[model samples]
Target: MRRIYQLALLIFSIGMLTACGDDDKPTPKPNPPVEEKEPMPDPISEFIWNGLDVYYLWEADVDALQLKSGTEEWKKYLNGYGSEYEELFESLLYIKPDANGSATVDRWSWFIYDWVEQENAFAGISKSFGYEYRLSKYSDSDGVYGYVTYVVPNSPAAEAGVKRGDIFVSVNETDLDVSNYRDLLYGNDSYDLGLADLDVENNIIIPNDNIVTISAIELTENPILLAKTLDINGTKVGYMAYNSFTGTDEFNLALNDSIGRLKNEGATELVLDLRYNGGGSTYTALILASMIDGNHVGEVFNKRKYNDMLQNYYTDKYGESFLEEYFTEKIENWDGEQLASINSLGLSRVFVLTSDWTASASELIINGLRPYMDVVLIGTQTHGKYTFSITVKDFLDNGEVNPKHKYAMQPIVGKSANAEDNTDYGDGFAPDYIREEWDYLGNIKPLGDPEEAFLKAALDVIAGNNPPVEDNMATRSGEQLETIFDSKELKPFGRNMYDDRIDSKFKDLTK
Candidate 1:
């Protein structure tokens, strides 16, 4: 009986072994489906959307973007545009056409694919023909002409002896009419300009025998064109034809040096020629303001107002004092120890020369100084840009700049007002004295010449002509938006409002 039980146990053990062996066989149940990992989300659009939402002055109107900020829906919406970031940015603008069908909103905002290049440009280092000019029609028979304003030192224009008063009768033998002038000058790298001298007596420009061909080249611009002291009615008047307020540490020193020279020369009054200055650094603007009058150091230089949302955000984060910018007397140099005092004129009043080109920081100087002293604007109405912009960029998780792409936006982040909190000159501040570029008969004169219309008008004012007989030129319309458009197309560096001292704060947020 014991032997029989043992045999039964062995048989049971064999059956269990066989069952285990069968489980290890190649007969397969359906393979468990491979688990797929979710794809990583792209952050480009999010970065752009968030940037505009925070810094754009007209952020409230961007309802489409704000609708789905942090959700997958926002990511999906951005991805729908693919990698066309420029298109995505343009769509976010607050735009509406006026009665003239011209889009008027957020015209100053622009995106740059290469931010490094943009930075170098605003610092007054760039490639160009280095000559700026204006296209105008003197008479129907005389035809359109290009008037050279000022040539950059060591530039192609300077090499070709292009002076401030030199005129171009035609480009490449073709008469420069308003219709084709932009195409001729702007769209080409090199062109032949039929040089002409102003026939002052005839009040017309006659073609010179010389035809100079100029090509574009890289140039580091010097903004101070003409700085001299004039003796008018025993009151030493300082005249400076400042092209742009390019605020660099080096540029600030240069500006201080210019003002210092004027001060040293015993200049009681100043005639700031901003006829072709289409705005630049606000830091430089403030420096000029301080140089004009340093007594207002502790007082408010200008008050900056951001969008309602950004304003509240800033006030919450940085206290209420963040909005006000006081006049700074000292400019600390690139080296921490290097410092220089602002060359303050310490005068009661100053005169500013303006044209259709005078805008941004130029207007800031005019508007900012109104409360403290007289800023008698001479020439036509300004370009009417009361808002300023900052350079917005992307970053990596490590706080360094993201190398994935080089994109930046110069969006209108805020509007600035003087100490009085007055910022209502959207149509531009009209000149106290209306002066014309061309005389009644039509002739463009040298910029710093005492006989020039704008400079002469300023000199007349300093000589106690309270209100010189206003010109019918006031009724004549000039290209008000030309400066802004030209900056975008011909010379991109022209449209700048970067403040070295203050703009660093915006950069900190990016980091």
Candidate 2:
């Protein structure tokens, strides 16, 4: 009876322990599966976004650029555009709204598909037929004709016997018109340019049987078109039809040599022809201005204003003096190698021959000299671009170009102000003597001819023979043709005033 009682008590104790353990323990649960997302596939878009965010002139005005990169929202926004990086870039530009509620989009900033081509163009090298022309519409008909403005020496066009002042009415047997001019002439790499002549009395373009077949080949253009001294009514006038401000070592030396030659010939005054000069390097512009007048070597030529971010950074780092570009007495190549002392004319007055095509660095010459001398303009209004751009490439941590893509950007990074703090020439600088080239189209003379309309006007002014600034179209019998386009506008470097110092300025910060 004692053993049975002990066994029952032990069994009851064990059951009590098991029940207590069961009450104390909790049940196990499986963890929810984790989500894995695919990574984004666009580094080009990221590059562009990052480049513009830091360097864009109007970054503050662009809301999309403010989004922190690498975040979910930033990734979403970028991925929404898919592969259309250009659309993404174009959307971020700060375009002001006009009075009519239309957007005055920024026309200066541009995208580059092939940075190699862009760099080549900066050096004044490109695949071209070696001739620039102006397309004009007949006053009475839809027919269009192109007049050769200038031809590159030893180029395909020059080899084919094309000359300045030659007219073309058709391309590849197709008559050029408003709708098909671009497609006909520019569409093909090679085409037969049908020659034409103007009938001033009938106000028509008569096609001729002569045909000049030309092809576009890679060519390097010498920007110094003509540099000569002219004897104008006992006044020794220097005339230079400078077409571009290519800041190459060769170009800089050539320019210095030209100016030295002019000075050697006893040039008392200067008549600078920039009718077709769209623009180029700011450094080259400074060099040219210094050569024109050496008195203000240390004076401020222009001041640059960047976006808020860059403005603050640069100001704090380099001070106000860093933003100012002064008149330099010495010439240097793009690589910062000292070339030579500037050959200054030391003239108190200068006459600039301008047109609607004269812009950027070309315009800079006018504004920079106005503070120091009398700048007399004798053509149509200037192109009116006070802004400048810098080439922004996708650079790796090693300071080399990003190897995955050839894309780049030429963004308007800053606005330039003269010593007077003036940047208000958006409507362009009006000519003191307005002489439209189209008005005397059929009667056009060679560029340096003393009888040429623009050069003659400058000469007349220098000779104290200030001819009346009247429209010559009334004197001519033909109806004044409307200029549809200028071939310079199609160039890769369109009125660009690029600063080569940008890379050096931002190098340390980027690294």
Candidate 3:
């Protein structure tokens, strides 16, 4: 009976324990949990130019874009012209917008492969077959006016029946100021036959209604301009203005011979004015740099980089893909001569005149020369591109040949030590003796202007040597290093492992 009563009491206690907890505190409500969001993909990863694995330039949290379908919003332009564009979509890269709907880019990823040129260069093209023209400063007819006393024979202008006596009148209704004419006609004057009716310049023949203005419309005809060397203050600056770097071998040859002649005739300072040199053949680059750096000829200071992945690329549903077979089939691209030894003109003092149009190899010469010689870089801060690139040749998977390109890129890849050996210029080499920052000095001065200032300043410092603002180099001692001498005498000659074998053998002999 007592056991049964105890069991009943135990059951009551158990029920009380199961039903109750803390009586002092009221029950509190549980807080709701927070949800997490997934991270976005890096746009740079989506961009692969022929498998050129340019990584993420910077980290970013992108904003929403406006698009109808595939989820990408914004515009992309073609990079360069010629084969690379037709095949590799080299013109366009991917991009992500920011918080304010503004498009953003980094070295890793721009909306297109051509972004650097588009944002930086004076002009860019959808197709890049090397051709240049001159905009006439005084154009009355369809021709733009420039000094045409030395047009190359059999050139487009020579074939078109234009001559030295002719002053360019107008080109497609766009009149050129004498200042920017040389590069304008060749660079800024590409016309699409398909877009004839939508002519923005009204320089196209649109049926009969716009006949008067259309009369000035000249198709893609690169004119040959004539020039003769003019003496500049007895220095014989050899003022042959090159409109473009596209090789007219005969023209360049004549120019070179003329320069040599100028040297003989008392042209002490050779001013190779490339302010208008928009760029051309690497073949020509060596010849030109050879003329300038005459002494230490063939010192290969710069080299271009080539990647097979970037050589032949095709776009797929997933993204861009590299062509191994194509790249392997023909590894040899670009002329071999371009990689030859660097040239040291060996000039104690060099004065270079540059402008925005002075680019590519022109910039390369400037940077490499700085480490070895005393140079006074005149003109504006250069185009700031100190690099080189090689042409890429590739084939498709099925052995079909795709369009190719110069595979253009700046590959100086590192800051170069200049000829003078003081410092290295990252983008563009600033002049040792800066006159004034003239991004557009040539525009303000006459045609033969940049050299004028550079020559004046250079002449002042030519026969003299100048010292650096300061010199700082490591001179200390520690476990890694020890002093070689104490007060101009050898200190005890404490031989270590470096000299162990020889030192021990010679110990008895010395003693």
Q: TM-scores for all candidates?
A: 0.83, 0.89, 0.42
lDDT of 3 by residue, 1-511 (tens): 9999999999999888867756645578888775443232222222223222221111111121111112222212112222333333222322435478774331222122443332122111122212222222112333223222223444434444433322333344554444433344444434211101212243222221221111112222121122234454444444445434433334345445654555556554554555545443443454555555566553553433222222221222113321111101011113322222222223555566565445555665565555455556655555554333222223334553233422232211112223334223434555455433221111223334433444344444443435332211112111111111111011011000010001111111100
**lDDT tens string, model 2, 401-491?**
8898899988889988888988888878998887887777667788889998888888888888868785467356435555798999879
Residues 390-476 of candidate 1 have per-residue lDDT tens digits of: 887786656677798898777788888999999987788898888765443234566677777778888887787765656543223
Ranking by TM-score: 2, 1, 3
Candidate models: Cα lDDT each:
0.76, 0.86, 0.34
Better of 1 and 3 by lDDT: 1
Instruction: Give every collision pair in model 1.
Output: none
| Candidate 3, superposed: residue stretches over 4 Å from native | 1-236, 247-255, 305-346, 393-400, 403-427, 431-511
Candidate 1's C-alpha runs over 4 A off are 1-41, 96-102, 137-143, 197-205, 333-338, 440-443, 471-489, 502-511
Residue 127 in candidate 3 has what lDDT? Answer: 26
Weakest 10 consecutive residues, lDDT, candidate 1?
A: 479-488
Cα error, residue 261 of model 2, in Å, equals 0.8
Return the TM-score for candidate 2, rounded to 2 decimals: 0.89
> Each model's number of backbone clashes?
0, 0, 51
Best by lDDT: 2
Worst lDDT 10-window in candidate 2 = 502-511
Pick the winner on lDDT between candidates 1 and 2.
2
